[model samples]
Target: MKRVFNKFLIQPKIVLSIFLLTSLIVLISALLEYNQSKKEINKLMENQSHTLLDAILISSNDAIKSYNLIKSEINQRLLNNAIFIKYLYENNLLTNSKLTQIAKENELFRINVFSKNGSRLFSSHPLSKFEQTFQNKSKEILKEIFNGEVDTLQIGIKESQLSNSYRYVVAVAAKDRSAIVINIDANKLVELRKESGFGPLLKKFTQNKNIIYLIFQNENGIIAASGNFKDLDDLNSSSFLQKSFNEEKFYSRIFETDSISVFESVNALIINNSKLGIIRLGLSTEPLDQIAQKIINRTIIQSIFLLVFGVITFSFLFIRQNYDSLSKKFRSIETYFKNIFDNVSDSIILFSNKLNIEAVNNSALELFNSKDKYELELNFNSFFVDLIKIDFTILEKEISINDQTKFLLISKTIFNDEAISNKFIFVIKDITHQKIIEKQNIRNQQLSALSDLSSSVAHEIRNPLNAIATITQQIGKDFTVNENENEFKQLTKIVYKEVKRINSIIESFLKFARPLPINTESFSLKEFFMQLKLQYQNIFNEKNILFNIQLNKDTQVKWDKFQIKQVFINLIENSIDAVNNNGTISVFAHEIDNKIEIKFSDTGKGIQEDILDKIFNIYFTTKNNGNGLGLSIVQKIINEHNGLINVTSKINNGTTFTLILPKVVEVKNV
Candidate 1:
């Protein structure tokens, strides 16, 4: 029973098919839900916009009517006062000064008495020029008043074109062939409209953060505004606002400014059968956008949950329905294959004719460090491209994955059976440890031969070099020459210098060939960097070069401190030589993957690409005075410590050297 259940559970094709179907259904459902949600949100926003616009329009109409009523009361009061004052003046109870006093008390701007014969009788205006203009305009109004045979008082309101202010005029005929006129200031009406009409309403609506602005405009330009009044001109000139006004209906539009998005709703402010102006209310659509995003997010999350649940439910039902008949037939076949596959040490992979991975055994999964066959199939092309390109029956190569190098021996065989024809079976065996041992053995043999040769050559050449140097120096000292023999003395001096140079070269070669002892000690990397900085500070200062060091933390690393210091010293000196004045050098240290990584980067003349590979070879120096053993010895020491050294350089840009060493060194006595 367990075997049959396992066979049903392990069929990847069935699980995959069910997962794909569920995902398709979930995706379609999620898309439909998202579309429906978007439509609902849009409808809600549109309705809100209409509702807001209607409220603003209603409030604005009331405000306008209130303003007009105030103006009418002011006009009637001024007219009645003018008529009473004329009656008093005609009865000799008031004089010009008294009339001026009355006008001042009433807050009237000007007072003029015009005769019925179209002549100015008296004026209280300080400016004679304005009084004359008023007199000229009053004559025409009096003619209309007398010719019409109207009632006691004639009142009218007019706007002053020069000052952009309103004036209330009242003319009263007193049956004495003369009329008295009073001019009342009407500018306060506009101020009252601004302060009480639109200000409070806009302030109330704009308390919400999303409301960007509210404005009321007429033919006379913006009469009232609220919220961000800095760019009123820009708002007025926007295409959205113009569209609203041109349509003269409740219209809403969205526009983008430099800083934010604005949604504007424009409604006509109509009162008493006239369109006064437009009341524009601007709101930020960010909240609406957030609503839509939340809907989408919820839909996606629900869809994912549904997909998972559906796949699981369907897969169980499918397995339960097909379990009985498949059990007997597949159990035997599965057991036979599972026994062979699990018992084998070598990894086995079966690929279809189209080069898609069909099956992988337990060993293959373990070899690739994968949880299942799917992971290996996904990474197979990148990890095994070299093996795939080879057309041999049996192949062997070294490859690296996740920083672990491995040597693989691969063998392929074709099967021509009816069900699995043109398919291939690959057997892969890991030989990494064995290959490392073999390479180490070969390296040891080469090093042994080189050490022997270097010892023999150094022993033979050092004695001759010393003897020659002594003889040349003795000749230079004993055979003191006059000016005529100066040439001979110079030649002896040159010979001595050459002999000393040859001896130095021999010493460097011996150092390269010999194995050095390593004293492994745990030391703080921070302290090590501090010592290096103190040692090289003077050199850096003299050259005007900046040196910087960065570290993740003060970590303890166990390694041969002397050898590693030597390696860095050589690299830093080389960098110093390569740089011009006022260059920069930086050192960085960090730990990753159980290894301590150190980097030395310099802004200096870089190495040529052609010779970069050969820099680690012995006696291959680009410098005129270089013995070329510095880097070669550095490489050898690093290899002995089981570390890696790499270099990258670009012409004129600079160079960087990276060294990776084991974080922990075993305490072993040599």
Candidate 2:
């Protein structure tokens, strides 16, 4: 079995290929993981930027509202002062002292009274030696007040000629169709808004390195910006800019370039229901890219380790399972050879040089009538007269066992084995049955000639016996004797009686010369067994032998019942003669494979191997006072019924006779 496994070996190249394939898979997985992580980081950063930009837009709108509210307060205070000056002058109570006092107390830059012809009639302080003041710049603003179209006018904040001052102005109509104007100095308020407005906050947030650019831009130009984002598309020229401004909502998106990746958060600034501009804040993705690279490196390292471990584990398992498969195939081959060795018809013996039997099959045991194989020894040299060597030579010879002769064809061959230098396989075939069949053919020819001779003799003798009978009948009817009549009658009667007996003998010969035909019919074997039991029970009891009959009640055979009954009787009587007290005879019958089977077993002095072939030969009898016709007739009856019979015997072990017959018998002409 080990030798069988040597031819096939597992290949190592397949393992190498698989390992390489798995490594490729791990590498691809690492790359995919890197790309996915990078995308997630980009999304997270874009969302954060959007939140920041939205907060800044809200704060900027509030700042614009606060600046407007302060300017409104200054304008309202100036209108009140202008109306008070108009009231005093119209009632003829106007004077320089009152104008100077108004300027000092109301924090006014200056106050002037202008006549309808655009001439300043009164001033809070008289013109300086080298300075002159101008009237209100827009005539439309003053025309309504001077022409009595409106009683007052408001002028929002304006830059003063003085570098640090701003002004809030107002006017009212005077009684003589003149305008009274007033203005306040607003320099301190301008300083306060510059310090706390949204401009400083935008500049402060842009100082972070991650925030690449922040800008407030509209269709006209950039209103304000922190950080250097030089290239920008205006609201009208850029679709995205225009959309964001019109929506007045936050919008975020990512951009990738050769050097770096950036995401921008955009929003429109709306103050008092007015769209000022859209703010764009750009955030850099350098930090997220670094984190994604770390994830990729970690994944690659872990996958490499797993690839190596998997290759090692797979190699180990493949080697073990491959070896197991080889071993099983070897075992299967050994079993196949062993099966053939056991079932072969010839006696096969494995022996050594010294005629010691190392192993033997079932046929070999049966040939030697051995129950235990170990007890048997090879008798190769003793069986033949010649100095036969255990080589590849065939010999046909006659051997005797248990005092009966048998024909055997012997052959042998040598095999290679380390333990046994000269291991020979000896084959022995029993050819006794063939020899007997050859002899039975010759004997049958002789019997046919003898039957013909009997038929011819009976015909020749029958003619004379008939003539003599007729003559004696005539004498008895026509002739009479004179002296001693009783003696004459007695002598004639004796002659007639002797002739009649001769005719009877001739008729018996004719009957034997022509064979009798069998009358076949269907019969239940169970009922047959019952009748056989009743008939043979006493005879078996006389010898104290055990008899067992087993059969199915429905078993039926189409055969000549009378002829089969005689066959059973012959077998039973033979068993009785062979066995001693406490011996056993068992019969088992059934139907199998569409045929009837009957097994007759006996624990009697079993028949010798050599004489088994001659048991059915005509005139061959082993028992005293036996005519040797019983078994011969049985064989003939079975042949006529188109059946078969087989026999196996072992010395002191018992004999089993197996009879098989067809279910349907073909009848012959009577």
Tell me model 2's lDDT, rounded to 2 decimals.
Answer: 0.76
lDDT of candidates 1 onward, in order? 0.77, 0.76
Best prediction by lDDT: 1
> For all candidates, what are the clash counts?
0, 0
Model 2 compared with the native: what TM-score?
A: 0.40
**TM-score of model 1 relative to the true fold?**
0.40
The residue ranges of model 2 lying beyond 4 angstroms of the native Cα positions read 1-347, 358-409, 414-420, 429-457, 468-502, 513-518, 536-554, 569-635, 644-660, 668-670
lDDT of 2 by residue, 1-670 (tens): 5554543344467666766887887788777877777777777776778788877877787777777787777777787788789889888788888899989987787788888877778888886431143554435558887677888787656676646568667788887789887877767677768855656867888999998878887788887788767655677897777777887767777675445567788888888878777888988877776787788778878887878787778768666866788689899998998999989999988866676667789998888776755555533435422423534478777776664457888887777788757667778899976765555555455555655786899999999888988888778767899998888877778888999998986775575457647788998888887898789888778878888988875787788899789878888888887777789999998888878889888898899989987787655798888866677767666666767666667789787777778877778747
lDDT of 1 by residue, 581-627 (tens): 79999899999988998888999989998998778766789999997
Q: What is the lDDT, from 0 to 100, of the residue 20 in candidate 2?
A: 81
Give residue 34's error in model 2 in angstroms: 23
TM-scores vs. true structure, each candidate: 0.40, 0.40
